[model samples]
Target chain A: MVDQVHKEFRRRDLLYSGALWLLSLIIPDPQLHYRREYRFRKRDLFYLLTILLLPLIWSDPHFHHIMVLGGIHGILALGLTLFLGYAGQISLGQAAFFGIGAYTTAVLTTRYGLPSFLAFWASALTAFLFAYLIGRPILKLKGYFLALATLGFGEIFLVMVRESPRLTGGVIGIFDIPFFSFAGFIFDTYLKQYYLIWGVLMGLVLFSKNLIRSKMGRAFLAVAASEDGASAVGIDVSRIKLGVFVIGAAFAGLAGSLFASVMSTANPETFSLNLSVLIVMMVILGGMGNLYGPIAGAIFLTYLIDELSRYQEYSLPIYGVILILLLIFFPDGIGTRLRIRLIYLISYWGRKRRREKVEL
Target chain B: MFLSVEEIVKHYDGVMALNRISLQVRKGTVKGLMGPNGAGKSTLFHLISGMERPDSGKIFFKKRDITGLQTYEISRLGVGRTFQTLQIFGNMTVVENVLTGMHSRIRGGFLSSGLYLPQIKKSEEIAIKEAKEILELLGLFGRWKWFASQLSYGEQRRLEIARGLAAKPDLLLLDEPAAGLTYPEAKQLAQTLSRLKEAGLTLFLIEHHMGMVMEIADEVAVLNNGELLAEGPPDMVKKDPGVIEAYAPRR
Candidate 1:
């Protein structure tokens, strides 16, 4: 009976994967179609269509740039999700690490005349080390204390970026950043940049997923649930907290570096305290604890921002109203509610099928 | 002796919590540590489990000094413990909680776990099988998928015990296992502890229930006002004047 059940679960999982694959092929690009249904998963077919159509959408000129921006935001959101959602540590220092990555890439490429790809990774590593050092002391503080400390860190980083004249190019920001490339193929065009960023984002997502399912992920969950309980159960709560913090920051760094290269500049304004808040908002609006929550949140928010930008003066207020509504009605976030609804539907269908089998 | 503590003292904010307490546990024996509320039984458990360091004194497991080891290190040293307040992972399923208990036994690291390596898969399979057997033993087989928070108080307590046992420890420290149990539940727990004892596992438990302690404890140690008051067989400790006086209601 156990074997049969296990086999059935595996079969269902495969079906789910196949359905996802098929669905990825059919959705229209968001840049081409500004419909309300395109903004969120309004229908069962919508998610399927989006997945199926992602590749074709990336091939468009304007959609390609939007995809790059989406990919960068997705990576940043994933990082925040790990720290805020899984590990239960709220940090607003993500923009600081993002700044670090952008600046490192900028300095390496413009000043040092190094390869952009090497600079990108170096920037990420630098951010990871910075996070490891800073996170040790900050992670000891709980909740709002850590949040405030991280906010301070972000502010300090922004100020330094603005003040540093020679290295950071001061408030004017660094320009003439070399484009991302592989084996001498420069990703200068929107299409090339889109594919490059999308590939990296997918890799980050897969890596993050695998990490979430690992022992480290379990330790993070334990720490998140209850520190005292985790300690009692022989988990090194502090170490696990620090590990997730650094890793999350590294993702932010990678996103920042990619953003710098894609935009061909590194500016203090780009990594502001507002960006940190937005990242945190994205994580929460997605669903803090769910893995896919941030992804959905990032994509949704990106499109919302894109659409709202046209309304210029009303954008901020519109965003505020939307967030308030989401929090009030869907406290678990869109991703979690959708998941719950899916499970309910599946179980309902299963029950009906079982009854029909009995009748037959 | 599998574990020993000598002249351990603990203080909290200048107040004595455990004053020069000492104890010994032989291999494969169920020893009882009994005391009134605030008698420092829990503090002693905390000190031994590496939750906190004793102000003065030494702790050893298998003749190796472990005075200042971390909790995870202590756990890795084959000393597993359950919490007084029931620290079972509430969000996880019963089997997942048990698998967490068997974390030390699983050898692969994050990479192996992420990649789902053969070793990790093998270990995971073994862990699931062992967890099932443990649940069956504890009469919780049917509730494997249930969240631990949904279980009855007695079942949760039993699940905590089962989690501790899943570690396959040389010594198990159970803190107030009978604190919230009903009469039948306490009786069942006593039977389970006795079975564990017969299976050659050493146990050090704190209990407020005298009936359960007296029924199952082969040896008993008494603490009063953060100091050891008496130590002997269960009957002898029960009859000790200090033990009775410490627990008795005051006029």
Candidate 2:
């Protein structure tokens, strides 16, 4: 009898969990869709079906463009999220790294007449080196100090891009940059660009997701929380900080290269301090420290800006209002709030079902 | 000797934290270091743990000179320590925090661990099992999944000990394990210490609670004003006039 009861309880738990997993698949939770739900929880067959069908739906030209831009922004946001969210390092120089990748790709393809494919990898490498050198001293400082240093870095990169005419083509920008090609297939249309960007984004997301669950990722979290405590437990806080910074910047650089290739241009206006601020805002508005939060922030901000272009005079005010509301209502960010609500609902329903079964 | 510290001197802006402090611990023996506050107990612990390097000293662990070695390297040499102020990964669950203590045991790098390779998975499973067992031993198994910060003050202190124990170190240095515990809690901690001693673990502890220390400590060394005042068996050290005088109420 006891064995039967225990078995029944286990069966019920499995059933309930299965149902919740199924429900999560159908629900369109913009914030919790990626990180908490899909990443950690076991997805049902329907979710797997949807994943396979997503590429087919993106075959349209307009949809493909939106998808490509989304992919680039997603990669950039994910990279920044790792540093600002998980590792607790604030970086306002992400656009600087992005600009570096763009210029590097442009100069290599247009000025040096190099293949666009090689330029992408070169851009990533250059960004990594730049981050390593700059991050060493800046990462040593915390909070406001670190922010100030990165801000200075952003401004310096912007100025350099503006002043260097021969190298960067100044404000008018570098054009006639070669398009990205993979295995001799040039990414000429929105459809090709979508597939290319999506492929890169997927690789980054998977790599970063795996990285967070590793020992190195735990060391980063430990250092972020308390440097002295982390040291006491045998973690090299400085090295971990530098490692995340470089990796994050590399991701930004990759996004920049893609952006440059898609537009066939590199310009100072494209990598402004305002763009850096926008990236930071996206990270914050989505949720700081959450892996998927930035994706939601990026998508929402992008679509909102695109839609708000109808009222050019009122767009800024509307954007400010939305940000203020998000800050006041869901301070932990939409991702965390949605996760908490889902967990609460699940547990509540579980208890109600238990009560009904007991009554029967 | 498994570990030795010789003529360690530390000065913070001419304020002597440790003046010619020296100690040794052999394999398979527990050593106690008792000292009043500002008597350089923590400073000495820091020096041994490699949190800070002494101005002049030689520290040897397992016959290897470890002077100026990093904290992580010192820990890797099988010298684990607990903080006087509770140090724990607050954001992580209790089990995760304990697994962190077993970090050095897992040889696989980030990629292997991240990919969850067969060997890495096996190691992680064993680590979780060992961590669970440690928590059970400390009577914290029920709350294993709770965040470390959610634990009560006494539980947090015990969690710190559990984390240190999970490292499976040859020598464990505990700094004031019973610092803020109630009398009953202190008594329970004494029992835990006795249990650990029976397991043949070498423990070097700094404590101010004389009652608890005398109960579990086989040998005691007392420090006052950055100098060793007494070192002997618990009974002898308890009755020593110098030990009593050093701890007596200051007017």
Candidate 3:
């Protein structure tokens, strides 16, 4: 849900800000693995700098609201990327966890008189519990079968929401959910909420990035490559996969809580297959395996959707065309692939400039 | 005996892959496993490494029964192995593939890893130092950043050795380490194995390349049709009539 932006200007710079946010989140590699083990990574330092500075300069409530949604989606996509990208597992049940979190926030704050902060954690816990219970049996299935299992899970959650009219508000959905607050400070407006959401998202981003640089992270990739090979190296493949799945579920739940607080509603329709597919599209178009790519994908898609909404009915088909175009050009996601292309261009220019200087 | 395999029998769909196969390996010595095709060479390695349970048998390492334990558990108990067909995590970096091999050696699980705790960083720094040393040993130090898949065939083979070595296993079981290497590469691998032996590491290897195996193996065990045909000093095993009949150059 975004505030209306009728300013007579193209938001190209905003799109770049998102792209740059993703581009700087690149490379936890080679240098960190060996020689300079203790030094602060320049890329990470710049990335954090970018996260804080961007919101201050862009003082549009509409842009802020849109980004608040983007941040929430960023969290969801990041979670999915860990399972799909890092651990080589897929899940279409992400929205089920999201719906649970949103409803938990809605029910607890409105009925139980619990704070939204407490409800946020409760959401994560409930999602984690569901993922653990279900992941044990369904995680054994691989490839498309696993996707089907997760899809079934999403459908089952929708049925439960519909059937439990007394608790979940049934067809009308829960409303008047209080604004997200920590201690006494309230995230009341889109600007304040933007910081709240991005703040949480940034912390998660750093945590995930750090995770991918460690021993367990390698185990995820190893499992992704080959379960037998991973086991041979003494990597506990099942535990690794299950852990990623549960963590991913927890992340989705957290995002859902944020969504409920910001939008002040919990509805069954929002957590449908379309939302799950859109999140998947973000990861695919942004990039998989690495965190920034998905976040970038989230940010990019948020703006595109905002702009295209003006066309109303035509937006859906336009979305399809754009996705195909992005994938055809950037098959591995635009973040890393575009960065690589940029690096090549820079090096080429550097050489050309040197030649010109020599000729002079 | 430092490592002992007692009558490991394995069946896949009612066909015996390993039938009552047994052998012993002394500490700090290279024990060679030789067999013809379908002679159950890799199956013996798989059972010992805990990839699959033996139909009935036991494997002891450092005086503990490791049979049927999880592969990682077996690895933690100082048993490491490579594959006949390469099992490298190709998309991962060379160092990451080896770092995965060091899984049991390092101790950062979800909580510590997610938080990026100080102790975890300390351990990671140590692990990276050690991992680099392993890569250097395999001549993959320069290209440590390269994706495992991008490496050439022989480089990937050596990368697997580098990975297996990262576990610091007391008993390393290599299944055809020289399977795809050229003559020079095989000779180089033989030297590396000898160096490892000289450093007091124990090795159990299955090799079809008799020259490399004969040069480095302290003792040899020959299997034909899932049963040990001969076991003795390399020179004596080569001379045995049974080995000559099964593993001879001509069919």
Candidate 4:
């Protein structure tokens, strides 16, 4: 086993390129039939390469830490992107699921001595179970009612945590949680953790991208377009809504578990409405329905928060003003404006060439 | 009896929208449902498509009792519907609109699709192939990548039918398909409906355009005052005094 490990651990680019080749191999080639849909394939590949190579250039431990944290938030935001952006549903209870994940890992690892890997999965499962239970009831409500119900559920989770002092550690929170490990390799350093989190994040983004282009993904968009229209096409709108909601919860759980392992703590205060609101804002600011947008939003907002901390007390007000400005300027999404502009430019070029041909 | 609605009654806020309306659409025929404004044409469509429950009635498609089934369930049972107001997914491109309409035909769910399983990839290829074919039939295949919102009104209406066809439903219920079409466009639409009828699909459509309905429908059912006023071959119904009275009303 040691020989096998050493043999495969030769070089980074070789492994990374091998991974990319495998990804390319699995990227089902219906692009010929969907020329327009696959228009951004080259750009996507570029992004993937950049994500893989980004750590080498930015080796600052602090930079890695911030990016690792951003990646975690990015995963959480990606989960909500599928639910809220594609399916056009509202959820304010994402923090509750995140909290569930953290607490699940914290309790299992601390008291029962469960391994981080198993506890991590266990956290996701627990959150999925909870979302399944609550989603059916809450997803029935649409619009602001759904939002309010989710908000209430988040509040209830906080209350439950505070009330269960023995289990949750209540106000003081749980500490000294072990770092994440799998098959004996510990993610103890910020650089290692950075790769780990971003790796997970990129996988999820790929999964989400694959999903949105598939039938079920289209059903989500249809539901967002019009419930009656979705039904007209044989899509079960409510069921799709519930499906995305649970998936989002599971994502939050995964994020939460990672948070616990990295921070080495779990607390009730961390999974509050503010976090939930922040995730929603990330989705909004990044752009809904576009997978990369929310993750970008998460990373940008994380860095923004870090940068603004220099202002001390004035950071929050400035943050609020900046967010409002972003929303106003990029209503569709941060990337949407750029994409639209690119389209306009391309069309303008096409028109100019056509006129030249006509003149000739 | 490929599709049947027996004594379907519906009302809204003390108004008798459809008073015990019973209708049947035979296989491979274009059945036109015509009525004056507020004569319950759309209300009956809502009930048949399972968008709304009838106060009392039974609806059956392919011998399955679908009276109170949810809209998607009824749709899965091979009933596709289009709304009086356009219900196109405007955000999606033309081919995507049709692909979404093929939801019932797709068996892949979140797990299979999100992971892009090999089977899902194969099935999706076939589905997209079929979607393009449907668009080809509507002459919108050339603009398959254009957003639904970018299509002109006539083209959008045809795109709606293209989406309906993508579902490959046995019986399609189109509500007010020709509501806002120009005369030439309506003529083209009538030809398209006639072509669809020849393709062995059942159609029960609601339309206000008398000429198009008369030209394409194998039979016409006229509704007036929440009651069946006339039912016969198009020429016979067109000549019926009761139908003429209800439509013109001596006004």
Clash pairs, model 2 backbone = A85-A289
User: On residues B73-105, what C-alpha lDDT tens digit does candidate 1 reach at each position?
Assistant: 888788888888878777566787777677767
Window of ten residues with lowest summed lDDT in model 3 chain A: A1-10
The prediction achieving the highest lDDT against the true structure is: 4
Question: Could you give candidate 4's per-residue lDDT for residues A97-146 as a string of tens digits?
Answer: 99999999999999999999999999999999999999988888989999
What is the DockQ for all candidates, taken in turn?
A: 0.31, 0.35, 0.64, 0.59
Listed in order, each prediction's TM-score against the native is: 0.87, 0.87, 0.90, 0.90
**What TM-score quantifies how close candidate 3 is to the native fold?**
0.90
TM-score of 2: 0.87
Which prediction has more favorable lDDT, 1 or 3? 3
Model 3, runs deviating above 4 Å = A1-40, A343-360, B249-251
Cα lDDT tens digits for candidate 2, A1-360? 657656777888898788666656544343432222223444334534543467687566766666677678878888898888778889888999999999999999998888888999999999999999999888989999999899899999989888889898888999988889867889998877877887787677667766766566666666666666676666667888888889889999999999999988888987988888888888887887666568768877777777787899999999889888988887877766765677678878878877776665
True contacts kept of 2: 0.29
Give the alpha-carbon lDDT of every model: 0.80, 0.81, 0.85, 0.86
RMSD of 3: 7.5
Which 10-residue window of candidate 3 chain B scores lowest in summed lDDT? B242-251
Binned by DockQ into CAPRI classes (incorrect, acceptable, medium, high), candidate 4 is medium
Question: Per-residue lDDT for B10-45 in model 4, tens only?
Answer: 889999998888878889999999989989988888
Given the true complex, what DockQ would model 4 score? 0.59
